[model samples]
Target chain A: MSATCHPSDELLVAYGAGSLDEAASLLVATHLALCPRCRAEVGRIEAMGGAVIETLPPSDLGADALASVLARLDQLPGAPMPRSPVVAAPGLPSPLRDYLPASLEALPWKRLAAGIEQAILLQARGIRARLLRIGAGIVVPEHGHGGMELTMVLQGGFTDSGTGYARGDVAMADQQVVHSPAADGGETCLCLAVTHGPLKLTGLVGRLVNPFLDL
Target chain B: MPDKRLAVEPGPGAERFSDLLSAVAQYGDRQAFALLFQYYAPRLKTYMRKLGAEDAVAEELAQEAMLAVWRKAASFDPGRANAGTWIFAIARNLRIDMLRKEKRPEIDFDDPELVPDPAPRADEVMATQQSESRVRAAMSGLSAEQTEVVTLSFYEDTPHAEIAARLKIPLGTVKSRLRLAMKRIRSELGDDQP
Candidate 1:
């Protein structure tokens, strides 16, 4: 029940390992920003990481390495610099102004379903990303990954295969699974999706769009 | 037998504190910068090594992560996150940069090189292993459920309700187990707690 909204242990472990991608990383970052107990647990894992470092026999460091770093450090004159308030604290994310590439935020969103709209974010090097916003209660077409698909919930909640996902939950799918996803009727569901291949659409319309989507 | 994408992490988490430190270092804080540098160097080294960096490359990246710390200390915020997590994130980002260069095959989960890391040292892991042995020796002192609860909490960092669900026990039962386990570990570690 709670798990429908929570990330599993493996996901957290992947996050700790730094194996997650940027889009999903954003989702998790947003989640970790708000959850305190999880924060402490992550801190403990970090402490464990430190303890691991302690057990390793000291490997020899390069002669010039320490000196080089010290030199670079010395070159940095101590000065108070301009800071972003959001960057400094856990409040609102930085206004979408600073980071979003203009092309990404400015895309024309197309209605894909009732209360659901999607805009392609960017495509390069055989990877395509899209920003999808689903109003509460909107249900997306049932689909599965063609190769591999990584989905991160940025805001609101989405129910896929009857499982609900809120902000920070990452849903991963490969060719082996097929399921339809819907959002809860409570909030707007925002997600960043990264797809390397294509998505297999389960419905009739999906069959038509599938050809175009195959890139 | 493998899906094409290299996506492994299927959940949420991030490093706001480190982002701040990077921003702050961009500003200027001498004292804060030094403190940041001192903390992350070893981790950066460890991370670089995991990325298949020779010792030289690993050492350089370690210095780079710390240098960023020195330059960006002014931006460090006590509120967002402490120095350690912030720096750890910085080092991790640096590790990612090195890893992308390895061009390692995507599906080979066995690539020790691709083990995404918070940049922990192998020695440090060995210490935890030793502590695990000590903890095991100490565990005989508690009931079976107490051992399970302590392991899940300390190792998994699971939520109370979740732990209950995981163990197929009542929430209250899980709490009791935790309480007993803590009492035992405390008495065992007594002065070691300091």
Candidate 2:
């Protein structure tokens, strides 16, 4: 099935141009693996970018640029040797498989609240990526973001502010957005969330616990 | 609607450059790489500067990107993308990696997820001497405003807010313009298929 919800076109274009930060790029790549339509769109966008580069006026490199590159080439690996294709695990997409634990059960889940668990994936240079597991019917604290936050649903679904996001859907929120996301009924929700900055808890209780949340 | 626009051809030197790249991949020919570098490095530096890089950083990254091209030549496929497209992608990827300020583990281009689709859709292939020409024709169709936002977005280090400020437009407007431009370009490329 096609993804009903996708990252905004601007985000995808940023991705195609290779301008997106690492955390955001991972979220988009994971979604692209599950959504063929988006994959095709990205392909076209990249092609368009290559086209623009062709028409741009050429700029001359420094006189030694080619010499420097050629000199460095000898120290670096030469041509890529042909190798067997990597076999991906059953459920995880090839890109995501690299970051995740061996299996769902192998995750090092840490308790953040009742019915809520989190596993920090990668944190570097002011950006953070994590996996969150919220039991069915659990409500995450209502909060706003300091910067951009991208949440990609990996399993089951979640609902926030009257919108339902199923597997492979992305929920993009920023400082201007404030809402409590609740896991949909039945299976627990597994989501990969990446944030550029810390979140600001909204409600009074949330604000009180905010100091401890460190999210 | 198949518009009556004729395809724009890539410059005369692209095929020879492609052959040079193939030589580098097959035999690690330094001379072939030097020829390819002479043609692309300057252009890649210009491309990087347009994306807001300073001259020194742009020069460094252009060299680094070409080095990557030398190392990854075996992964390049002429059937999937032209030499211009392949070199452009290498530069663009390097730009993004530099902006992130953290060198990620070396990404393998041969990964299935990373490879461009091996076959182009029949209608999307332009009736031109070079595949890159069709893409250029499609880009030429974008409105000036749309093209402005698109070009600015390629500056990997510049945030959307900075782009909006530079263009004297609201941030949301920049995003909306980019959205519209991308859709039009996609259609122009004959990628409107469902």
Candidate 3:
């Protein structure tokens, strides 16, 4: 089935072009695993990418590159092994299964506010990957971003800047965007967020409390 | 929907590349691999440079990707993808992996996400194979402004904001142009068909 809310075309193009950051690529792949139409789209983009490479002029790889590769072929394993299919939990997407803890409830979550919790998974030079859980009916602090933020909803729904995002929807925000998100009252919301930089909390109260918010 | 002018005719080198991969897969033919290595290593290096890799890094990555092709040749299916497509996919993944490696702690190479997806359905594979030259033609047909952003995006790890800064265009403009360009390409390649 196609996802109701999908990643922007540019983002998918970047992913297919292999130019997106690793964290962002992971989320995109996870979404692709669930949505067959997007997978087809990315597949087309990748094929086009390969064709683009074919038209470029060649570069030199030095004298003994082939000889070296030939010499090593004898030392490696016999045949290429097929990749084992990932057996992920019910709600967990295949791409994310390896990085996350066994189950969502088992995650080492830290309370961020009265009804919000977060668990960081990976942190690189300028990027951070984490899971956020907001209890139903809770409103998150209004905030902007220092760079780009991609939040993919895993469960339930959240409304941000007048747009309602349900499960499998990704809300992409950047420096120009500032908004508060509130979890739908029907169920708790779970989101996987990959941010390139720190989020700048907005509003007077948000500014006063920004220093205390680690996320 | 097929464009007669955009149909790709497989040349001798393309056939040779495919046969060599099959030889490597079936018989562990070092000779076949050496031939592939000679042709692909240099091309891959050039490809890497086009994607913004510096000289040494591109050279290193090209070798690494070549070695991977040798080891994984058995996994390649001529029915699914051509030699150029298969090899370039390897190079692209390796480059992305290097980017990830530099930032995070060492990644588990065995991570399932890193694995290639199963061969696409037969109809989709046919569509992709047919669309190759058409996609090329569509890319050439893009507006210069659209081409600039698309090229930078395909070449570097620049985010939308950085692309905007480099081109001195608004971020919204960059996104809109890219979206329009992609839409056109998709239409040209017959990707809009159900």
Candidate 4:
């Protein structure tokens, strides 16, 4: 199903402008793979980018610039016409496919608690992206965020504060929101989550688990 | 000396560039490629400079972007995008790779799981075709404040928060301004397809 919840227009604009950090970009790209609406939104923004470029006054390149580029054109091999399509891995979105193995079952998951497991996909520039798998009917410890946290459900669903998020839905949380999300009893919920800063666990169980969690 | 006859002037229209690009794709037309290089290389360099690249690096990246245009011309679909939009995407991807050295994972159009957009009406198809001019016209209509935010957001490498800081405004205001600007642009472009 298409996502009901999406990243804010501002966030999608940033992604279109190519200003978002790598981790955040990855999560949004994965979401775009599942949401055509956001893809169309980004396309319009990119057309604006083209308009911006068209209006920009030209800068002066070196006098030999054209000559030099022309010289090198002959040296480079001709690329095949109409570029080949990439073979996407089954059951995974195209953006996430490269970072993950073929199947979720093959992931080397690290258990954070009795029913919660996480596998970090990437960490760079203070942004961490991970796949979170919460067992059915389990409640994650109550937590606030140090900065922005973006979660997109990949499989099954979860609920927080009367809001239901199923496959392809995104949940955006920041320092102001302290929530304990529970996975639906139907199936284990698998999510791709990217966080800009540390998640602050606030509950007594969370406080106890935080010391060992390193998240 | 290079043949002076091959130097085609970049005309004052976007469709002409699209045709030139198509010629480059159909046959290895060096003259058409040269005209494109003449028009776009300098603008691409300016784009790089605005993103904080030094002169040398900007020049190199601009050249690289042009080289990529030559290599990837066959993939350019004139029905979907004009030359400027296609080249902007190329330059943006190159910046992500060469400047930031970060991976911006992309959706594969061929992926089976991808949700297809609703079929477009005949008028929607026409609007899509004229999106370049529509965007330019809409951009001209933006308020000066909205224009500044839109320009800086696209041209500068700074984050939205930084744009707020630079403008001495709150981040919320920056976001709202951008949202309003996009709304205006979208309305003008008739982009409310959904």
Give the number of the best model, judged by TM-score: 4
User: For model 4, which pairs clash?
Assistant: none
TM-score of chain B of 3: 0.68
lDDT of 1 at A130: 69
lDDT of 2 at A75: 94
- Candidate rank order under lDDT: 4, 2, 3, 1
i-RMSD of all predictions: 13.4, 3.9, 5.1, 1.6
lDDT of 4 by residue, B1-194 (tens): 24443454666455578778887887878888999998899999999999999999999999999999988888877766678888898898899999999876777767777776665446447446456777777888999999999888887565699899889999999999998997887677644554
Off by over 4 Å in 2: A71-75, A79-89, A103-108, B1-23, B26-32, B103-130
Could you give the CAPRI-style class of model 1?
incorrect
lDDT of 2 by residue, B24-125 (tens): 777777777777776677778888887778888888888888888988898876655667777888887777677556432223434564433334444324
Estimate how well candidate 3 is docked, as a DockQ score: 0.34
Superposed model 4: Cα runs more than 4 Å off: A78-89, B1-9, B120-130, B190-194
* Best-fitting candidate, scored by DockQ: 4
True contacts kept of each: 0.09, 0.46, 0.45, 0.71
Off by over 4 Å in 1: A1-4, A77-105, A108-115, A122-129, A135-137, A147-156, A166-174, A185-188, A194-197, B1-43, B74-87, B97-194
Q: Give the Cα-based TM-score of candidate 2 against the true structure.
A: 0.83
Output the number of the lDDT-best candidate.
4
TM-score for chain B considered on its own, for each of the candidates: 0.36, 0.72, 0.68, 0.88
lDDT of 1 by residue, A68-115 (tens): 665666566656643333332122233221234444446668776557
Supply the DockQ value of model 2.
Answer: 0.36
